[model samples]
Target: MDWQTTKKDFKRYLEFERNLSGNSVHAYLNDVRKLEVYCEDLNLEIEKLTAQHIQHFLLWINEFALSPFTQARLLSGLKTFFNFLQIEYDLTANPCELIETPRLTRKMPSVLNIEEIDSLINAIDLSKPEGMRNKAIIEVLYGCGLRVSELINLKISNLFLDVEFIKVEGKGNKERLIPVGQQAIKYLKIYMDDIRVHQSIKSGKEDFVFLNRRGSPLSRVMVFIIVKDLAQKIGLQKEISPHTFRHSFASHLVEGGADLRAVQDMLGHESITTTEIYTHIDKDYLQSVITQFHPRS
Candidate 1:
């Protein structure tokens, strides 16, 4: 099959069969496109590819000095694509079967201390109409440990505020109930009642919990800008993003003796290993505590 046709089928598989998010589907497709370009340069066909060609592609990408993490991700995407070809097209053998992924060092995420988090939130100018909305956004982000994608797509209909829980659609369109802190619930109500109710919401956007002043849903970049502005206002030295609040949320929970599995559930992580990163954060916290409090020289 032509590379373009194969890509279309792969996109459908990623979107429908695998139920990946739009961003994830886009990233995987981009990875395949890179390989497609490499193949085209050599006049190679899809079915004609073998492990040596795939290795050559990896070596070729290496010439561009892509980061190991990115290299690993590209290899993973190709592996997944080849696996799909094996299943759907009855390919005799997957070309990427013997490929080894590049090793990556997992960088620990930056986390905000309770004081820093408070400082960031307290820096908001509440006189503006959007102030309360921004407050609610930060609260929900930290309080629920939501990914920015989940935060932006959060729906008002999913908010069971009376019960102090909100349902969010996580990766792969999986839904989960996350308990909302009273602080988050309070700010959410204020934003909804005071700020959101007065907006001229665009048609088809009414159910969205967060919105721009124009009444459309907040874009992901807008959320990042919000977090960055807050950090600057507080003169915080650490560079961070909306995801940092999520890391802080989990780190704080683990430091307070919350179970790892529960943290995984709240964060909507598919695997416990993904959540275990916080345990490393927890260990760092312990080290600091001992360094500060221990009497030994």
Candidate 2:
């Protein structure tokens, strides 16, 4: 079968059987496309892609400037795709089975201190119509450690402010209930009642918690733009994005001596290895403890 046909089948398998999100499906497909690009670079035919071909591909990827973490994820996606093709289409035996992933070194992510977070929050212009909505968005982003997509998809119905919780649909279509902070709840209520309520919401976006000026669901890019603009407004020196809130959420908890397992559960991380990055962030706080308590101090 043509690789295109096989690729379409793989996509269907991911969506129907694996129940992968569109973003995840696209990422997996992109990994496969990398192999195609490599083949074209070498002036080789797609049908000629075999285990030996994949071995060369892996070696080529290693030579690139990409990080081992990103390379490993791409390799994992390739492994899944080939396995799916082998089982369903009876293609040439899976070519990526025996390949090894590069050793990944976990790096600590940057976090905003409480004061920095406060500065960013206060920087929002409250006089404008979108200002209240923006304030609520920032509060919820940091308060819940939400992914940009999660924040955009957040529905009014899923809010449980009375119970101090909110339902978040995370990666892989997994849903989890996270505790809501009092400050976030306060702003969210104000925006809902005073701002979002007055907006002329389009039919489809009525349930969406955050909306654009036209009352449509906010895009992920808009979230990024808002964060970037805020960072600039506050003269924040650190490179930050929507994901920085997630990093800070975990880092702050770890620094406060929260259990690693509990932080992992709240973040909805599938593996403890992914959660271990925050433990590294706590090392600085650990040093402070040592300095304050040690007889050497």
Candidate 3:
């Protein structure tokens, strides 16, 4: 089959059957496209490609000096594509079955200390209409440990502020209730009661907890720009993003002796192993845990 039709089929498979996000589906398709390009340049039909062709494509891409993490991601996508071909198209043999992902050196994400977080928040221009909104955004981002997409899509109906919990819609549209802190609750209330209520919300946008000046839902890029602008304003240059608050939240909670499972639940991580990074980030906390709970101690 031609790569074009195969790609369309793969897209549908990922969207409907696998239930991946749009960004995730595009990423997997992009990886497949790289292999398609290599095959096209050498005039090799994709259906006839074997493991050697796949290997050759990997080697060719390696010339671009991609990071190890990126290399691993690309390999993962290729493996998924061939598996889809085998299952859906009934291919006799999967080409990328035996390929190994490149070993990646995991780097610890940068965490914002409480003081740095306070400084960033305090620097907001409260005189402006969006100032309280920005404060509330930072509070929820750090307090709830939410992803940017979740923050942007946060609905008023899903919020249980009086009960101190907010239902977050995470990856794959999975919903989880995260406990909100008192500070987040206070600022979120102010933004909603005072600021957002005054806005001329457009039709169908009223339920969104956060809205722009035009009364529409905020975009992910707008959130990034907001965080970046705040970072620049405070002169804190640690390469922060909306996710830095998430990492900071987990790290601080781990340091404060919160249960790992509880933190994982709050962050909506599917695997406990994904939440294990907090243990590494807080070395003293790790030591304390060992000392307090370990049989060897």
What does each candidate score in C-alpha RMSD? 1.3, 2.6, 3.7
With a 3 Å backbone cut-off (N, CA, C), the pairs that clash in candidate 1 are none
Q: After superposition, how far is residue 212 of candidate 2 from its true place, in Å?
A: 2.1
* Candidate 1: residue 98 Cα off by (Å): 1.5
Q: What's model 3's lDDT at 237? A: 78
Candidate 2: list runs displaced more than 4 Å. 37-50, 60-65, 90-93, 288-297
Better of 2 and 3 by TM-score: 3
| Candidate 3: tens digits of C-alpha lDDT, residues 96-123 | 8887888876688899999999999998
lDDT of each: 0.94, 0.88, 0.92
Q: What is the Cα-based lDDT of residue 48 in candidate 3?
A: 89
lDDT of 2 by residue, 47-139 (tens): 456778888887898788778888899989988987887788676777777888888766667789899999998999999999989999988
Candidate 1: 10-residue stretch with minimal lDDT: 88-97
State which candidate has the highest lDDT.
1
Error of 3 at 152 (Å): 0.9
